[model samples]
Target: MVGGAILRKLEKRQAGGEDLTLVTRTSTELDLTDQTAVRSFMQSERPDQVILAAAKVGGIHANNSYPA
Candidate 1:
């Protein structure tokens, strides 16, 4: 999320109006834990760059429940 915000800021600095492609995905569309799907998406999209925002996020109760 932080990186995406930073990217947006950087893009605004450019004078030329460049096409912006935001590859935002909901958790339901792609699971970060699934490496294969991620790799495939990367290959197909072929984005010149990438901003990694997805994380293994959890709540306090969930973290306490699975202390791994």
Candidate 2:
């Protein structure tokens, strides 16, 4: 919900000619917990800024499997 709101705001700004690019990826496409994957992605994209709104949402089993 928070990420969606931020994304909407960014989209509005972009539409209003903010001169910025929004880069996004789904969890399936990019795993935030993987250091190597993140490093490779950052090197390839070289984005000026980043909005880290990623979260891991799941129930008991998932929570047990992946503890933070």
Candidate 3:
């Protein structure tokens, strides 16, 4: 959700004439657990910036259920 907000901000900035390449992915598209693909994409794309938005959830139950 927070990443979505930031992406919106980037879109607005790009719409204002800035050059930006917005690369986003859900769990289905790019699972962080796959280190090989992640490394390959990172090396190939070479983005100017990176955002690691994965963080702790609200409670222990949420974390325990989705042990990524």
Q: Which digits, one per residue and each the tens of the lDDT, describe model 1 over residues 13-65?
A: 54357677656676799777799998988888888877676656578888899
lDDT of 3: 0.83
Residue pairs with clashing backbones, model 3: none
lDDT by residue (1-68, candidate 2, tens digit) is 67889999999999999997999988899999999999999999999989898776787899899998
> What TM-score does each of the candidates earn?
0.53, 0.78, 0.72
Ranked candidates (TM-score, high to low): 2, 3, 1
- Give stretches of model 3 more than 4 Å off: 55-68
Instruction: Find the candidate with the highest lDDT and give its number.
Output: 2
What does candidate 3's lDDT look like per residue over 1-68, in tens digits? Answer: 67777888999999999988888878778878899989988988888899878655667788788878
* TM-score between model 3 and native: 0.72
RMSD of 1: 4.4
Q: How badly does each model clash, as a count of residue pairs?
A: 0, 0, 0
- Model 1 pairs whose backbones collide: none
Comparing 2 and 3 on lDDT, the stronger one: 2
Q: Is candidate 1 or candidate 3 better by TM-score?
A: 3
Note the Cα lDDT for every prediction shown.
0.73, 0.91, 0.83
Tell me how far the alpha carbon of residue 37 in candidate 1 is from the true structure, in angstroms, after superposition.
0.4
